[model samples]
Structures are given as C-alpha cells and as structure tokens.
Target chain A: MALREDQILRYSRQILLREVGGRGQQKLLDAPVTVDGASDVLDVAAAYLAASGTPLFDRTTHGGFLAGTSLESFAPDAVAVTPAKGWLGSFATAPTIDVSLFRLAVSNGGLIGVPGGMPWPGELEGQGSSDSVTLGALAALVVQRFVLGLESSLVKVRNVDGRWQRE
Target chain B: MPHAVIDITSQVCPMTWVRVKLKLESLDTGDTLEVLLKGDEPLRNLPRNAADDGHVVKSLDTLGDGTSKLVLEVRHG
Candidate 1:
C-alpha cells in the first residue's frame, strides 16, 4: 500500500524505527488487531496504536476511551479494540491476549486461554500502590509489538510484596 | 532513474527533516529525490542527516529569495 503524504507525517516517528518502518507500519495499518478484554492495558494500547496511524474498527467514542480533545482518528488503518466482557470466549475465534492485574489473595485466580484448560497464568499479589496503568501499558506494548511482527514473548509482570516481578 | 520531489519551505525545524526522511523512505533503491526548503536549520541539517543515514547528497544549492534545493540519491543496504 502506497503511503499518503499525511500518513508519512502522522507515522514518521514510528516509520523511522528500523523494526517498524513503512513496511511494518503498513502491516500495522492493514492488520485488524483486536484487544477484546477491557482493561487499562488494552485501553492505553488502543490509544497508542490509533495515534500511530492505526484506527479503531469500532470507532469507539472518544472519552469512552481517550477522554479528551486529543482523540482524533485520521487515516484510520483498520485496527480496533472494544471492551469484551467475556473476552475468554473470543479467543477461540480471534487472536487475543488475556491481560489483567490480579490480587494474590483471590483464590483460584487462574488465567484461562482459548478452548479453556490451558496452563493457568499465576496470580499476582502485591503490596503498596498497584501500578495497573504501567502494567497495562506494558501488556499493550507487547500486544502491539506482536501484532506488528516484532519479537515478543509470554512475559508476565507480577507484583509480590510491593515489588514487581518479571518472568 | 526515477525521482520524487517535495517542497518543505513552509515547514518548520524538525518537521522539515521528518518530511524529508519520510519522502526518502517512500522512494525505491537507487531513486533520487529533490527537496525544496527555505530555512537555515533545515538547509543546514537536511544534508547532514541525509549523509548520516548513508544517503548520497548529490548537490546542495541555494536559490534566489532564500529557497534551497537539495538532491539526494537513495542507497539502501
């Protein structure tokens, strides 16, 4: 797909990335990335992707997510994510990531994947200020990176005794 | 020997180079580009940036009324 002049301006910063050049940007634009789960992580992820030239397919109203005049969808590139109440069910049909910040005290806090019965992700319980935003943003970054064909792994950020753990 | 042309005389500082860089990205290997701008920062920095990115700066010439023209040959490895 030929990039328009405005698109060049809109996505120039990312396009400058060696990992995410015009070709990669085009892939992002063409890709239909769906973050079905409604979490702060997906919220921030949607914003960054849309700002970077990818558009939400749902055209989810601003403030419904972005919450300011800063939300503008120009040159929308067919990328969107909506709040999924039952996100686990969608995994069977779509490529989706299950993301949530959890409390350690919650019993049986298991992460379920598509078709169910997958190895449950561990529960993250921590003390002090829970930085859900940071965790969510990191998850979003991983999702977007993976969608853009960048190297990504099944990394988890768990909170333990007020400290964050990466595995 | 295909070439592309863009005029960024009205654009400001970093954005000028940003536009030029994007324009260059849009070009194919061995393609040439002509950039038109009218600012000291852009004129001073564009050629340096082009060279820094390994593109060949064919020529840099100032025009009457303060506009400048630069020729860049795209070379990607």
Candidate 2:
C-alpha cells in the first residue's frame, strides 16, 4: 500500500533523513518490532517507534506495572502492545534486540559491570524519573535504527551519575 | 508514462512530497508517476524535490483550477 497523506505528515521529520527516505520509511512500516521489557522501561521506546510509523508489539512482564506507567502518555493507538510474562527466551523466537545498552549500573556511587550487561540493571533499585526518560528514548533509538536496517554498536547514554559515559 | 497516479489535492506539504516519493520508490527504475496536488506550494516544491532526489520531473501543468498535475520518473539507487 502507498503512504497516505496523514502518514506523510506524521512522519515527515524522520522521512527527511537521507538514511530514511521513502523506502526506508516504508521498511519501518513493514517491519513488526516487538519491544520486550517492563512497561516502565519500554514506554518511551514504544512511543518513538510508533510515532515513526513502525509497527510496534509491546511485551511486558505479566504483573508489571502498565497504564500511566510511562512518565508521559504516548499517542493513542500508536502502540499495539501485548502484556505477557515468560523467560526472556520467549523473545528469542522473534528478533532478540541486536542492540545493547552500555549504561552504568551504579553501585555505591560508582560504575560496575561491562557494557551491554543487561537491558535493565537490577542495581537501579528504584528507577528515578530521569532514568525512565533516558531509557525510554534509548530503547526507541535502538528499535528505530534496527527497523531501518542500520547497525550500531553498544550505545552509551547518560549514566546513573547523570554523566555521559561509554565503554 | 507513469506507472501510477496518486491524488493529494486535499492534502498539504511534506505529505505531498512523501506520497510522491513512496509511489516513486514502489516503481522500477525508469518508471514514472503522475501526482495530482492542490495549490501553488506543491506545484513549486514537488518537481524541485523530486529532481533533488535524483528522479526526473518531466512536466507540471495547471488544471485550470486550484489543482496542479506533476509527472515524476523513478530513479532508484
């Protein structure tokens, strides 16, 4: 199917990128990407992908907090999410995210572990508001570029220290 | 000799170019498309952007109303 008028307007900013011309945009629309994580973590990622016209299937923990979960509300019907609970291996049947988050797992006011240790480091204890915002956006970035068939190494975002760090 | 035609006379900018660009991408190299749009803005921008993307804009003509017709040729990389 052709891109409709509203679709064009909705995605013009992304479409304008040289890497994401008409064909690349269509690739996003065609690819079905499932973000597997807690609702809190996947919130921003879900919104970003959906906003860009990427078909999003959201997977969250069975009892994980959802709805009013994200710091902000994403557009209605923008996300087609399925709340589920199982081993991370369940996501293996589908494309396990090829990207990694090399964020600091702050332990005792310092960093620990190698980059890409886990999507969500347990050391976070209670996720701060800023953590949610940063993680959400980072998840979206990983999913969007993957949809466009672009390759990126471990992405280092602002760490628990609120400082940019890479490994 | 466009392979397809899309009418965006009721739509606005960026969408005009986006719809045209998508239609062009769906075609084979050397295939062409004809777009129907409204107002002078699309008329001014459509052909120019199509050319900038390395596609050919064969012709643009007024429909004697607020509408305009643009002809574009696909040139895929």
Candidate 3:
C-alpha cells in the first residue's frame, strides 16, 4: 500500500535520509520485529522500533521499568502485538552472554547484544548503571539497516570508557 | 513518457519532499511528475534535492494563486 499523508508526515525525518526514503520507511512499517531480553534492553529497543514505525512484538517477561508502558505510546504509527507468529527481524539483549541464544540470533539473521562492558557469562556489573540503552538502540538500528537493505554486519557493542564502541 | 500530478501546497519542507519522492518512486525513468507546492522552503529546496537525487527538473512556474508548480522527471537505478 502507498503511504498515507499522515505516514508521509510522521516519517518525514527518516524519509529524508538517502538510505531511508519513502520506500524504506514503508518497509519499516510493514516489518514486524520481535523483541526479547533484559528489561532495560527491551525498553530502549522497543521505544526506538516503535518510534520508527516498526510493528513490535514483546516477548520479554522481565517488564522492569517499562512494564506498565505501552509501546504504542511512543508514536502515532507505533503498534504492539503479543505472540507474533512471524516477524522480519528479532532483537535480543541481556546482561550476560548466552551462547545458544547468540548463535540462534546470528543464524537467523537477527540482532543480539549484551550490555556494553559487562563481563561475559556473568551478571551486569552495575545492573541499572549499565549501557543497555545504547546497546539496545544499536540493535534497533541493525534491524532498520536490514529492513532498508543497507549493509549491516553482526558485531558486538562494547563500552570503552564512556564511549560505546561496536566491535 | 507518463505524466503525473501532485499538489503539495499543504505540506512543508521534508514532508513536501517526502510526498514528491514517494510519487517519483512509483514512476519509471523519464516519467514526469508535476508538483504544486507553496512555501519558500520547499520552493527552494525541493528542486535542488530532486535534482541531486538524479531526477531532472524540467521546469518551475509560479501560479497566480501564490503557489509554484515544479516539474520533475523520475530516475531510478
């Protein structure tokens, strides 16, 4: 379907991007992305995806700080669904590395990340103080890149000092 | 070449370009799009942006109703 006037206005900022014009914006809206992870990661990823007009499905049980919040509250075009049977992309996050889950995400062409600077196979060093927000936003961008047919690679995000670096 | 008409007189800056870009995406190379737009920002930027995107600006005319009409040709890779 062609973009409605409201959609054109709503996504105008991203639509102006050379990598994300009207066609790319429409692809984002048409894509249903599933989320799973720690609450902080889920919070940031869901917010970014919803604001970008990507239909979101919540698979997280942690809830955390965003338990009561609705993804649709983020934007006019934001939509949230439960038990989504199919999706174009998946994002998973956690404070510790889960080898099985990581392999699954990479194999399925999905994005998965651990909070930057967190030690492997262990709990987050400071939990709420970690940079899950930045990691989550990067994961959401990975989904956006995939949707727009941009070149994206599976990489880890690590916080070096105060900077979040992708490796 | 096919011709299409769109009126973006109610839109501003990026949305104006967004609407025109979407229309252009639906056409073939050499297809013409006529856009009726109002406002200085879109008048100044739309044609420049369209041309930068590889579409040709055939003509731009100001109507008596204080609106400008821009003619663009589609280009796709």
Candidate 4:
C-alpha cells in the first residue's frame, strides 16, 4: 500500500535518508517483528520498533513491557497483532564480561562464543541501565537493516577493564 | 521517456525534497517530474540536492500565489 499522508509526514525525517527512502519507510510499516527477552532490553527495542511503524507480534512477553504505556502515544502507526512470520530476535547479557549481546543466525550456522575470558561470579554483576539501552538500540538497528535488505556484517563489542573494546 | 507531476505544497523543507526524491526513484532514466511546493528553504535547497543526486533541474517557476513549480529530469548513474 502507498504511504498515507500522515505516514509520509510522520516518517519524513527517516524518508529523507538516502538509504531509507519512501520505499524503505513502507517496508518498515509493513514489517512484523517479534521482539522477546528481558524487559529492560525488550522495552527499549519495542519502543523504537513501534516508533518506526514496524508492527509487533502480540506476545505475552511484549505486553509485560508495554502494560502501562500506550504504544500509540508515540507511534501513530504502531500495531500489535496475532503472531506473524517476520524478523525475530532476542537479547541477553553476558554476566561474565559485562556485555549485552544480540545475534541472528542465518542459513549457515553462525558463530557462537564469547571472545573474552570469563570472570568470577559477582565480578561483572549489576549491569546498568545504559547497557540495556545500548543493547536495545542495536537490536532495533539490526531489525531495520534486515527489513530494508541492507548489507550488514557481524559486530562485536566487549567490555575490557571497564572500557568498551570493539572487534 | 515519461512525465509525472507531484504536489508537495503542504510538506516542509526536507520532506518536500524527500517526496520529490521518491518520485524520482520511481521514474525511469530521462523521465521528467514536476514538483509543486511552497517554501523558500525547499525552493533554494531542493534543486541543489536534486542536482547532487544526479538529477537535472529542467525549470523552476513561481506561480504568483505562494507556490513554486520545479521540473526535474531523472538521471541515474
């Protein structure tokens, strides 16, 4: 379906991007994404996905995060419906290294392993809010790229001595 | 080879250009698109941005009332 006037205006900024024109915006609105996992991470990702107009599959876990908030308050086009086939992913934190991870395995079995050494229990405990936000943002970005069919590669970030190291 | 017209009078600076760009993307190479808009920012910026994207600005005219019409030719490279 062609974008409605409200949608055109609502996503004007995103449509302005060369990488995400009107067609991409339409794809996002039509996309049905399933986001499930820890509430902290799920809430942030769901908010962005909603704002982008990506429809979310109605799952009990999703409702757990959106119970109090109205999705329409921020996303005029956000809709949650019966479970549908679409992009799917989850988020989890690596307690040993104090890092949040997001991965989607494609046709070929993707790599699976933590690159850094393990830490003793309670050493990397107490993951902060910032970590959850970062993980959620990354998850949303990956979903958008997948919906738009954009070329993207694996990204890894590890917390090394309280500092982030990219590999 | 083809000609199209789109009115973006209600749209602002960036969206004005965005709508025009999308129209251009839908047309074939050498196709002409006429955009109707109302704003100084878009009047000044759209033509340049369209040019930067390899499209040709065929003409731009002010229609007396407050609207301006811009004509562009798609040039994909």
Worst 10 residues of 1 chain A by lDDT: A111-120
Assess every candidate by TM-score: 0.61, 0.65, 0.71, 0.70
lDDT of 2 by residue, A54-131 (tens): 655444544222233342256554443222223233544644442223122322233322225335433343355465
Ranking 1 against 3 by DockQ, winner: 3
**What tens-digit string does per-residue lDDT give for candidate 2 at B17-45?**
76677777778888878899998888888
Model 2 chain A worst lDDT window (10 residues): A98-107
lDDT of 1 by residue, B1-77 (tens): 33999999999877787777777878888899999999788889899988987899998898979999999999775
lDDT of 1 by residue, A21-84 (tens): 6777776665444434454445555566566654333223411223322234421332332223
lDDT of 4 by residue, A44-115 (tens): 767777788777654446432233264556664465421223233432220011112453311123222222
In candidate 4 the C-alpha lDDT for residue A41 amounts to 52
Interface RMSD of each: 2.5, 1.7, 1.0, 1.4
CAPRI rating of model 3: medium
Badly placed stretches (over 4 Å) of model 3 are A60-73, A80-130, A155-157
lDDT of 4 by residue, B1-77 (tens): 23999999998877778789888878889899998989789889999989988899999999978899899999975
Fnat of each candidate: 0.15, 0.62, 0.77, 0.62
DockQ of each: 0.21, 0.51, 0.70, 0.58
Ranking by TM-score: 3, 4, 2, 1
Ranking by DockQ: 3, 4, 2, 1
Instruction: Return whichever of 2 and 3 wins on lDDT.
Output: 3
At residue A79, candidate 2 shows an lDDT of 43
Residue runs of model 4 more than 4 Å from their true location after superposition:
A58-73, A80-129, B61-67
True contacts kept of 1: 0.15
Shift of residue A71 alpha carbon in model 4, Å: 4.7
